[model samples]
Target chain A: MKAFETYHPIVLFAYFASVIGLSMFYMHPVYLLITCIGAITLNLLLNRKSFISGLKFFLPMFFIAAIINPLISHDGEIILFYIDYNPITLEAIVYGFAMSIMICSVIFWFGCYNVVMTSDKFLYLFGKVSPALALVISLTLRLVPRFKHQITVISHAQKTIGMDISAGNPWQRVKSGIRIISILITWALENAIETADSMKARGYGLKNRSTFSLFVFEKRDGFLLGIILTLLFINILGSYFGVTTYYFYPTFTELTVTPISIGLYISYASLLVIPIVIEIREAIKWRSLKYNM
Target chain B: MQAQSTARADIYSRKRLIFSSIIIFVVIPIIMLIGVTIFNDRKYNLISMIIVLLACVPFFVSFERRKPQAREILTIAVMSAISVAGRAAFIWIPAFKPVTAITAITGFAFGAEAGFLTGATSAIASNIFFGQGPWTPFQMFTWGILGFIAGLLGQKGWMKSKIALIIYGVFAGIMYSFCMDIWTVISYDGLFSWKRYLIAMSTAIPFTIVYVISNVVFLLVLAKPIGEKLERIKVKYGMLNN
Candidate 1:
């Protein structure tokens, strides 16, 4: 429910970079599982309360993913069910489950990031150089909730007028939906005009714009940045040397997993865990401060 | 009276040109990339050069007009990018998968031009992020039409009702699937006969279900919110001509 929470943007950025880097280089099922687990565990640790609250949003999606993914992906070995010529394999099921886990973990991480990395963090990082771009990102984030709220109001108003879209057949429903959207279009255009005028009146882009930053790079940020830079350097080197390679299609073969690959994977997986570590450390620090007081 | 009318008309046409030019410069190359990938099996690197060349057109035209402030233009460009990212989020939503409703909603909210941009951009960008192949443009056009239809219908007030949105979503889904199926046939070419198309349909049935379900869910979650915000924006900004 809170709009923003405190966390280091660099750490979060590093974490995402590492996860993406690892996923690209080392894409084994087992390694993916570890990454997923790490993501979920961190998600739970950081956003326990929000996770509980947001379960409604996530639960239906999880079920849909679990059931639907396996049905669509007709791959893997160890057939479990045979309907007509199609085979539903256990491998496919596990793959789907893993995929769902991966997706959910990513979503949770995004949610955490959204909470922690407020527009201020973005502005802090890139505002000075690209104020216009930073402003747009901030506006977009602000717009999401505003847009959601507006839709609710419009639908309610329409319902009162007996134009209930939910009460109709499929074809009629489409017609009615178009009508509502037309209204929305007019509204959005008008809003854009007002935004343009307001921004103009305020003398935006009059000269080179300077941005204000709230976050001062501290010792912890420096330490985390150094770790991230080293890890990224290592990851780049690994990729450059052709350390991780796998072939699919004509035949599937796994290249020998070197110590470097394992080390990189661990580092990548641990990157996602860093936020949770920071949160725990913060909680401990807060508790000690309270005790001393 | 004739002279006055001519002057007003000239101004209006000039405004339209400015707007259209901006859109063309920003959106056309993105579309061309999709076109090349679908029609020809070329990699995406080729499109980057095209983008650079095409991007200069907008800068030149905008610089010529000098009516709309640089910040205003930048804001539009930035909004366009965010819209692209938002549309991409729907794909990453996992359960939603790839559905026509996103195209429809985008088209309905932004208009045909923006809808086209959203459709094409989402297709290309998602493919690039996930992994690109030849089918990218086909998917782009398919989704682009969904938005185009939504915008076209929305402009006529057809998308105002919930029933209409749902129906539009379903129709868009069907159109998308049908188009994708055609592309499959084209890709397979000689290997896929008339009978194979039928077989392919049967195979694609599950995906069709997912598409429909995603469309329905997306409309249910998004329609009302998008509608109201857009209305507010319209009123506040004086966007529509009466």
Candidate 2:
């Protein structure tokens, strides 16, 4: 893990929320290309093994999302072909491809988010703002993997008793699975009840209780957050004011590279590449230290 | 087996729900549409979406405050977790989902309001494991509606039959794909076009069929035991008296 990974969880979450928000809120093709490359690269850098494995899921999603646009959108400037008496346009196809990349890359970023935003980080981020809802959401996010593990254990135990879901005929197996689930539901409710009672006994939600957290916002984190927000604000302002606008409708507009847009582009790129830059800097420092050693 | 004591407490909740549903599902879109007509700008769609998502906060706040017992709140959380996990369990099966079945049952046992919250919550929560995007809010609303219908209609005489549940599953499957297809159509064309929507629907029929099969399969497998357990919990705890 890089030094960036060890920052206060709130800093990390704010970075993600801002970055992902940019991906969704900004539709400029240039901005999108930068986002696509940055998200995928950072993701691969984070974990190459998982990134490759995720290709099996992301490729199809990209293609489907990309292809569907040209199929339905016939209002583009460059008509490519006619399918079922409707015109398919090159502009639409290109727009669709951009959109798909936008979606897939955001998904890649979220895949990274899943890795970095552990349950503790998630709880800390929301706990201060909305305690009750945060507590519930953290519990739910935490429970999912636990529930999956429970399913495996239950299925294993059932198999030992000759009541495996995979063993019986289809209907009988389904029935058997439900029987297992019946046991699981009882367990789940009882488990939740016990948790609730435990919290109650601990004086939760009864008064203003002070809690301690491990994360403290350092000056480095302050700088990081300030830079991210400043760039994000500038980029959002550019788009919101239509300074970075492009048309893909009845007529496609040329993708102009004006000075202002170029600045916006730089801000957006720098915003996304912050993590990569940090990693590269750390790598150079480590190499220099080794040479000195 | 729902108790009589809670009905008076919940009547206000039901009233507020109906009012908010109209406001969320009907009035907001109409306002956006009117704005579009006045300005001749379709960008109002984003404004409308943001407004509706914000409205969810108040709705949830009401759910939190009026929630009679801590048990029901935890129950909803656990059910949402189960639905998310169930979706993850079927990761190998593309487009197949047990979410609808479970969400539908949550509606059936709980009232329409709880049903909507469960469906919506499950969608958002599961997307954390799957993916979240512009599609998240739409998925939340659509699945919430499906659950509301199941709760509103599923508890009655014929609707309670297994055959009817299967039929509802099939319809729900199509409805989900169709609802999502609107996002496809609008995002593709920048406006809701009938021709585009039709093509989108036709293109997605295969996925819809999988939804049908998966919903039926999972519902058949899940509803009875989960439903039975939920009902027993409700009666034993005197929950959701309305």
Candidate 3:
């Protein structure tokens, strides 16, 4: 496991929640830069190949999202040009760019989140809040792979009967597809009954049913949680004080660099940099230990 | 046995009615008020997400309170997993997914709460494969509401007719796109703009038509067989009858 992911699920969840939330709400260019860099860097550290490949999808989306606003919105003082008679304004373009960046940063953070918060971690976290629903989610997650396997089995069996989905006319193919799903439904539902019977046999839904999990909260987790909460509190305070709010409509506000605003920027940066720092530290520690060996 | 089961149904529907009323009447308004006043109409994505999550809480709380049987929970799991797998089965066809049909069928057989759970759970579970995004909550809420409404309408006799099913299929398609587009418009500016939303909707018309067609086709084709199968399972396993 990576160093950051090794922390308690609570800490990881909180960190992603706060970072993604802040990324969505804060349109300040500086804050966006910090978050975008942090998210990209963290993603690169965690999964470099996938992060680079994701850009192929995100790049077009980013440009489309950024381009659409100016075409539709004509709500600024500085008019750029007429597009088929409607004036596109500087403010609209700027707002579009900012919103696009915000959207991209949030998506990137989620990429990082997806990497760090595996389904097991997510289910573990969710299990604390709603155990029954969590179990339902867990069971569904488990069943998806099994169902896929069963689909293959069922399809092969059906193929032998000349009802092959891939080798039929268009209409026949559609019929075969539906038939496969139909047969799968009957098979799954019938099998589910036996699964439930086994569960009942094993004393499911009993009182005070204890769930076994591997996660345990250590002192380091508490300390990391403390740091995250503190930084998050600072960022929220900064937002509440209107320091993080940037205006792109009507007229652009002059970028101000007050001490308090600077402090808020640093705090936000530090918050995002926590995981990157931890990963780097871990890498360095492992390198030194390897050298000693 | 019949009288007792009817009594149980009465209690179940009553609890659901109370919860829905509280959410629709009180909770949603208060949330809108807060969203408008405090958020100044920004953060529509976040605010609506919170609202969606809040709307689902009552259903789950009641489900938990009822001490749901293993088979009951397994039924929901099985239905949700099927919907997720259904998406995979139809992966070749872009914009054609049987998730809504399966979820709606589950609601038709099981009840609104099970339908809602199936819709919401499948949304998240499928995202594990497709990748989760800011739109996950919106998708969950949209599909869940589709199932929820399907369950309510399924309780009536007329929803079994072909015309009613067609109407519902079109409605579910439009509703899914409509709900999903709110996030699209909001994601652009962190607030809602009618002009931008109109543009987004106009551009999305082709996809929406596909959704409507696919939903109708799937519902008409899959509804009878799957609904019958689900009913048989419920009867055989005595699932969710409480």
Candidate 4:
């Protein structure tokens, strides 16, 4: 699918603001779950193809987040099981689940951002800060699939020579795998050095690095930014007033879902939705532009 | 036949360099680092740091080559970073609680180099919030080795099976504890006593079980999907040799 379609910068900005806003304020499992669902739904609708493509990266992350978070955090109540007298509490489980949802949601949002923001948008946002660093970030995003491709080719070639990593004893297999990584690492570093040389040759990071952006701040962008600012204000106020507060000491206090809390949650959830809204507006604008042409 | 033979030889030579570099740089140094930290009474904190710094030598040397191109290098670095960060972020999630498992998955999906980099990078970077200490290198080496081994297992297809992944997780957990025990011995100036070792191992046992279980669950859930994605990436990028 197309990586970047025209959307108001405010929409993207607001979306990010909300995500950061929610993550900072809330600690409830329910709130995290709802936010995650909202993120997945928005991602699927706005960029269905990229969402699927991102699963390669996201699926493993989901499991990793879901499994390993609870073990380290052993401070919860309602012990589920005891191993060697160490209580595995339900509090830990709930807390872990909440954490996994938060992690996965953030990742999903980032993936969505990667598609929508594009290199051009990133250039627009951070070009002034450091062009060299921005270029590196952009180039890296474009490079993930490329690296994956190389590993496959190398593995296949190795396999033909009876070095198939998958067809070995466990120890031998581990050794073979290390062999592949060494090759890849060597290849990657070599590529980086060459790139550094090329950049130097081209005067990259010279006295002044010039940049251009295809984005122009429009009326919609302003409106979107205004909404985002309001949301940010609300989030800040909520946090300041302790609207999203919870306690895990003495005994676990279930988060009170007050009207203010609900409002905070809704506003934060709306942040993720902003991107989809921007995408829809852009799609309509493109259609109208096409008709005029 | 001659042309094919030449192409095959080129591939073979490339493989040889890759294998040698891994042995000399990644594997050997890791063993030595563990050995020095465990067996010697010397201040290994500085030496461990040097070993980590030295590890970058191969990366710097290899990156000098022209074949993989700028885009490919950036891609590898970013993905490696993402995988590392992703695994580390699991710690922030309170429910899943499987540190050992996550470590293994990082190793499995990325391979030893990526695994090592991820482990070391996570330990170093996470210290920004978690606070840094003498334990950083040891943690790096422990997790890095876990990831390295995971990658090795993935390459062998052992990571694909449930039982194998579980076994690997247990092995990784035990190995990590053993390695850390050695570090404690060096750092604390404890007698090379079985009681100290047992105490260290016992303290880590609960976490190890959690680690093993987590590793198993992670492998069961993500190994196949990540593998497929890696394959797709290979094809899309023309990484496969014709």
Candidate 5:
């Protein structure tokens, strides 16, 4: 298990929510750099393989976003060049880069989020607010695999009967595909009736019924939550006061440095780096323990 | 005793009425206000997301209030799961997912609310595999609304016609593409710009065409069989009556 993921679901959730929300809003170069680095670092620490693979998609998206803005929007000054009688401005390019980085960074943060906040945790959170919907989501999650397995079974049966999906022309293939899905749907809906009956037999909807979960709010979790909230509030305060706001249209905002701004930057960076710090500390601790053993 | 029970039920429904009204009328605008004022830069994506989430709140609240039976809930679960897992069956084809067709079928058989739930829940469930991102809520709202509209039309008995199915398929395609492009334009430009939006839409014409074709094909092919099966379940089990 990841060390950072061991925090209470609420703590983890609040941490990601604030980080992602802040990443979206704060476009100051310093803040964006901090978030981008923080997102990439946490993603690398948590799930490197997927992160690297995801970049294959993210990179092209980034360039397209960066390029498209200047092509369409000609609001900025410092025209770099002309394209089909349109002048490309430096400000738009910078703005585009900023937007792409912010977008990619938010996506990376979500990548970390998906790794840490597993479905069970998510369902637990929602279960608090609406148990029925959460139960529905849980059931759906369970049913997806079963349905997929059943599709394979149905397709194989069809194949034995010589209606194979892969062994036909495009039109024939699509027909076989639809036939397979149609059979699967009938089977699933029918089987679900029995599943529902079993659930009802177990008194599934009894009033005052309680939910079971293994998660507990520990002291460490509370401590981390407190720290996260404090930092988040400081950053929000910074944004509210216009300390973390930057502009790229018309002209660039002079990159300002001040005691308050530096303080805000530190807080933002620290907030983003919290999980990375936790992961590194846990790894070092584990290594030493293994060596001692 | 019967009179007292009736009175209690009246009060219960009244409370639900007020609750849903508050969520729809009061809370949704407040969320939009916050999104616009507080998160002002390129905040359309964020605002639309909150609105989408708020839009689904009333549905869930009412569904919970009804105290849905296991079979009803399981039925929705089954539909949503089928839609998500159905993506795998078409893995050979690119972007020709049956999610919308299946969602609309759920709505047509069940009701508007069930349709919305299946659409929204399947969006989240599918993203659980595809990896959740900023677009999840928009996709949820678009598909859910598609289902909601299908339910309304289905209730009118219009969805039975071949022409109606084709038109709805075309509409769902355009709706999905146009709605997603709103996010695309906003995220790229950090705000809404007509010029940028038009360019984005024009560029996405091919994708939109694919969406329209695929949706039309799936709905034309799958709607009848799935709708029949769902109707059978409802009739045989005597479920989802409310």
Candidate 6:
């Protein structure tokens, strides 16, 4: 089994949560790029199906996110050239490149999150803190799949009534579309009410209503989680001394290398790839097992 | 006597909204604009977004503190859920989203606070399906601001006509693009640039137009039916009377 995927839900949740939280909170380009590369690589490896599909929309967005920076953010020194007296600087382009990389990586990581943290995992993590919030998230997740199904059913019913949107004028087409929406709204609300009623009848919201869950916290999970926490601790401590800090605006800072900083970087890199290493180990075992069989 | 008391309460809440709206919509952005300009720092941008969200959320609670919260909460949640679902449902209409119109209508029917939460919730909840990024905060801010404004205009009877509502929708679409454009620029350059902002604005004109057109279309279609039903709920349940 893939050790990362099969870890205790809490470990996986903590791993993803810490990764996303840290990535967003940091503005350091070097650290961010390292994490970005790690995130993208892991995402593509673990969630290839969604990676390919999302690339269709996400690919263009990545370029747009990067290029738009140099266009609108005119900060930094080291002028590359002048576009009518307003200089287009190397710094801005580099900042754009880094920011875009960070953005794409965060998005890719989120996609990986969706693949890894199913509704059950999220509910398991958050159910006790606030059941209402958990319910809303789970309900919203369910809504997408059912919504697609209902649309086809509604469209077919409309076709039978000879009010086909495809055959109509622009105004009529919009009217028909609105009519379909109106119908869906009524049905959806009624459905929501029924769900609320059913939930209430089941003794939901009772303080003593205990949950049944199959998730178990194993020893291996605890060991991995300990390692993850240690890496995070060192990284945060190192950040105060500006380990990954690289200034771009006004002027670019000369890159520095030191032993402690190297240690910090190595820890951070290992933290990012812990799951990947686990994944590779599992794949190699599978290959060896297949040959033996 | 009953009518006069209700009128007085209405006046008080409207006054509170105007004050809070100024803080959320005007004061904070100015602070961010000046903070970044003077400090010449990128860290401030990140902190400012947090400040923007934290500062506005308390005001939302203040507006609803004395009101019946259950109905308001349920309504906001349901409407946000609807808007999020709608965003995912209509994938063919690129750049056009019913989420903004639905958020605007929620603000019109409920108060600005309700509108804000609905919009914010719509953004976060939809991103569950659409995928989240650094842009999540920006999306929440823009949509919440749109709802907040719609509520203010509704309170002032400015949204009286269908035409006015449609105009608001169109303006909101442009505002969304502009705000998102600001985010893009800041995210790219690590700071804002007026010249580059203008160029980015021009390039985004086509997308903005599509957004405006979609807002108009969705509002025209959904406002009457949804707004009326919500109005009926407000009266029937006598909910959110504060």
Q: What does candidate 6's lDDT look like per residue over A225-267, in tens digits?
A: 9988888878766765566667777778776777887787788
Higher-TM-score candidate among 4 and 6?
A: 6
Q: Write the per-residue lDDT of candidate 1 for residues A209-277, one digit (tens) a residue.
A: 554555666776778778777767776565546553332212344546678778867676566566666
Chain A TM-score of model 1 comes to 0.64
TM-score of 2: 0.83
Clash count in backbone of candidate 6? 1
Ranking by DockQ: 5, 3, 2, 6, 1, 4
lDDT of 2 by residue, B97-187 (tens): 8888888988888867677778888886787777555677778877888888888875563456789889989999999998887765655
Candidate 6 local Cα displacement, residue A264, angstroms:
1.4
Question: For residues B131-167, what per-residue lDDT tens digits would candidate 4 score against the true structure?
Answer: 3334555676676667767767776766677778668
Off by over 4 Å in 6: A8-10, A24-33, A52-96, A123-130, A166-170, A204-206, A212-221, A249-251, A287-293, B1-41, B44-49, B52-74, B155-157, B234-242
- The clash count for each model shown is 37, 0, 0, 26, 0, 1
Give lDDT tens digits, candidate 2, residues A1-293. 46568878877888888888677555668887899999888887787788899899889978987887877667776887899999999988887887777667767887777777766777787677656666666667878887878878888988888888987689889777877777788888778777766776887666578888998999999999899889888986786667776676776777887788898899999999998898888889999999999
Candidate No. with top DockQ: 5
DockQ of each: 0.10, 0.39, 0.69, 0.05, 0.72, 0.24
lDDT, residue A252, candidate 1: 40
lDDT by residue for model 5 (A84-162), tens: 9998999998888888999999999999999999999999998999988999999999998888788788988999999
Weakest ten-residue segment in model 4 chain B by summed lDDT = B59-68
Worst 10 residues of 6 chain B by lDDT: B63-72
Please give, for residues B46-102, the per-residue lDDT of candidate 5 as tens digits: 666677777777777877887888999999999999888877666677767888988
Error at A229, model 1, angstroms:
2.9
1 against 5, candidate with superior lDDT: 5
TM-score of chain B of each: 0.63, 0.86, 0.89, 0.65, 0.88, 0.82
Give the per-residue lDDT digits (tens) of candidate 3, residues A1-293. 28988998999999999888878777788998898899889999998999999899999999998988888788899987898999999999988888888888888988988888999999999988888888899999999999889888988999999999899689999888878878888888888888888999999988787889999999999999999999999987787667877788778978899999999999999999999999999999999999999
Candidate 2, superposed: residue stretches over 4 Å from native: A56-90, A145-172, B1-52, B131-134, B154-159
- Quote the lDDT for A129 in model 2: 63
The candidate that achieves the highest TM-score relative to the unseen native structure: 3
Task: State iRMS for model 5.
Answer: 1.5
**lDDT over C-alpha atoms for residue B225 of model 2:** 78
